[model samples]
Target chain A: MKQRLVSPVRMVWLLGALLIVCILASFTLGHYPVPLGQLLGILGSRLGLPIEVSWTPQMETAVWNIRLPRVLMSVLVGACLAGAGASYQGIFQNPMASPDILGASAGAGFGAALSILIGLSSVGIMVAAFAASLATVALVFTVSRHAKGDRVLGLVLSGIMVSSLFQSATSFIKLVADPNNKLPQITYWLMGSLSGAKWSEIGFILPPMLAGLIPLLLMRWQLNVVTMGDDEARAMGVNAPRIRLWTVLCSTLVTAAAVSVSGMIGWVGLVIPHMTRRLLGADYRCLMPGSMLGGGIFLLVVDNVSRNATTAGIPIGILTAFIGAPFFLWLITGKGDHYEH
Target chain B: MSIEVSHLSFSYGQRQVLHDISFQVRQGEFLSILGPNGVGKSTLFRCVLGLLSGYTGQVLIHGTDARSFSVREAAKHIAYIPQSSRPIFNYSVSNIVLMGRSGSLSTFQTPSKADEERCAWALEKVGIPHLARRCYHRLSGGEQQLVLIARALVQDAPILMLDEPTANLDFGNQLLVLEQAKSLTRDGYTVIQTTHHPEQSYLFSDRILALQNGRILTQGAPSQVLTEQTMAQLYGAAVTVVSLYQDKVRVCVPKHITIQEEAK
Candidate 1:
């Protein structure tokens, strides 16, 4: 029971260093490879700093225009999803709870697909996806409010129903979409990619992501009380219902924002928090930041593999499942007893 | 009085669960509520904790109406130890104990040094400082219950309400937990506990209240309230009360059934 892992402080440093390395490696090794020095030089030039190195326009474009934004997006989206997932799991007091448990991903997927079908602009698609995700969560909340017996179970059950409803809607959109024109685009989007990640998109995602993340980070200690169950939390002087509502709201917002940008990147949200918990015990004060850093590093590595491992870049969503599924299997089977207690 | 409930009644939809229940607990007094299943002992605890609303009468904590108390305000006066259940996540024992300080801490603030000291003190008081760093869910049922009691102690509440504190424990652990609870009254903590064992009530409680069908069948000192007739009527089984230890200690034993014994 007292088997020691790395201390939490050192764990944070390790993950942070790994994230930095992944970011730098992702910048240096892409389809159009830029050397590390030139990559740094190009970054410095863009930041209006004096650096003595000759860098070509193509290297600058690849480093600044394409790879940097994609890498940053992956980090933010990964962190956002992981943070949301951890919060959801704590609030529900269920280890299996994830960011997509309440239909946010499904709703965003349907919105993105519908926008593609209707030929909306990229901004419009993102906005539509965001709005749809929020709407779907609101619907789930309304439905679960009317449900009797075990409020958390009610929310989860309602989430399943609403997710299926949105999933069918997405399927219908795909079916009716123009096969040659919109179909491939919709399919690729559903599979999820960071290929289209742009610097402008960061502006759109950063605010909501921070808005959702900051509150959860601040309330991490209170979340421990929440996991003790509602009646117990209440008796301990924590307003379980109010804290739960805020948690749900923040998690849904962050999750929807991430999905809208990254197109249904799965597994990172569900797996990263569990991985962090194994290393750090289930104290949310450590778990929240640990999961955030772990998730960022995880996706950075996955995104790096997706882009560099193949001539034609693999979609990140596919790679996440490929890596995450096996890892999850090992987690549940290998260390299952640790989690069960 | 540390806690008082007067004519408190509660219902779920059309069916009533607690009917005209009244009780008063003084400072440092140990009151054990004895009841069979479905007799609303838990419901009464909830009412006193202000977790239930729309009840018929009043619950007064330190002479103030309980209905007006916020969750934090209630926590200041009363700490509750629920029956132990396994948590989903494996939190460290220290973190689990630290959660008791949540009522006093602000929403965004972490536990201060003083608060941590109090948590450590509570753990030491419960005699489980060795288990402080162990994962809470990894502990035994008795150990988990002890941690919960330590959590209640950290809350620094005057009145402690425990619902079946020894329900799932082994015989030794049951005695250990009950002994700990009984000792708290000596430290100026008013304890209200619901228990199934009449002998435990007889041994540990200064006052005993026997509840059946949401009503108090009898309420007084343990020797007067816990009689063979009331025990039989409460559980619908014939029983005999016997005294031992120079007629100071009382115990209840079931009367043997002639038919069942012959079949056996």
Candidate 2:
């Protein structure tokens, strides 16, 4: 039989299949190792399939209340991070730029850390976290507006400096918290897990994610122009300065929200966009959605391993660092294809 | 649209570059700025393009002060192709040209079918249509300059400005760029350019504006401004100017013109 390579249509089907596998696999990878049948039964029950099951509270609590929300949160946060990263790298015209490195992430991390230092509880923490994230994004924007026109280098450099400052202060603040009571909690949160994600956290993130992604999708072609450089972009009739302003504002907002809740999910925001570029090419029309799916699924898998990779219950970031390091090294030293034309 | 600069005096940090330089570009004339290096050709062009702020003068493009125009609005009226620039990254040739469309577009809008057609036409007009899909940075220097000119052409602005547009290009590419500039001027688009080659000013320009040490030395026809005396004063060297076929001026510099020899 002659071999037929898959078309883009088939490839899209493959992406959908992979998404299903990831979701199912995520539900089964936790500590208790919920059986495939029981996992499906719980999911089906929630979806109104009326499957009968043992009413053991452990099954209901672990599957419905705990693992389900955590997994969903992982997908949502990962998608947001990856999308934000793609937009950011596009605007900066640099392949290595990520949401965290440019100060947006650090700023959000600092705001949340400061809120924790002020002794807010779980209910208050969510409010403080989202508010602080938005506030940090606003600070980056306000500082970057040096002239009447949009200033790209100005925004990026300031972002870097501000982030470093916040990071040092966060370390100092973390040091002074009560070691026995609050220190361990702060440490765990910094590991960046989906364990804290709730319905309300989802609610807060959804609005900005949708708001941010809509403009990006609409202006996808302009992002193509921006990649050419600002002067060239202006000649194309893009109001290059204002486009820069709007894009930075939206990307910063999404990144701030992602960093606020998860602490700092590293690599997904940077590497996923590059991966999408390699996979789908630099055309932002497809690359934007590709990064969204790729980022979420990558994190979903990492989170699965974090919950049950070892008996020690490893912190998510440690596991992510371990998984991401070898690939990053391979990306740097291997075929030299990351910025392919 | 006419470009009018009147009583324009500009300086850079106490070092004056242009003093009371006044000129008017008729609605579709090809105007050339002719001067040796260190003259105010580029400074004058930048001031007219509104790239610099706080210069005392009046630069009116299409009957409005340059300061009154937004960057995009100015781009719509006056398109610029710099002498050369290094983007240092990979972007498609078509994408590079598409930037000329942004000044007329909104943030939420995209390059339309009409815009893409214009990009194609501009690239084809400059004779580099095949490079549209290739990486911009990998093109040769001549090809890069052509690509930038194509971008400006696509802007479809009424007034086009080029600064040293032929400085680094090879002989053939220089002809190519200059001829394209000439065609734009012929099409009723006011073309303003700066050149070090005095002969080039006569060959390609309808009006020559010569500068020496931050002031207009002379502004008129080639025969009126370019002389053996003017070349000697600008370079401090002995030279000769000759009129060639088709009213083109030919410039020749002696290999061994010394002050001692001249004094003797």
Q: What is the TM-score of chain B alone in each candidate?
A: 0.96, 0.91
CAPRI-style class, candidate 1: medium
Cα lDDT listed for each candidate: 0.89, 0.75
Which candidate number has the best DockQ?
1
Cα lDDT of candidate 2 equals 0.75
lDDT of 2 at A94: 75
Model 1 chain A — which ten-residue stretch has the worst lDDT? A332-341
How well is each residue in A229-300 modelled by candidate 2, as lDDT tens digits?
776565444555666678777776677667666777788887777776656556665677777888888888
- DockQ (CA atoms), all models: 0.59, 0.31
Residues B40-101 of candidate 2 have per-residue lDDT tens digits of 78788878887775789899998899989877788888888888866533456776787777
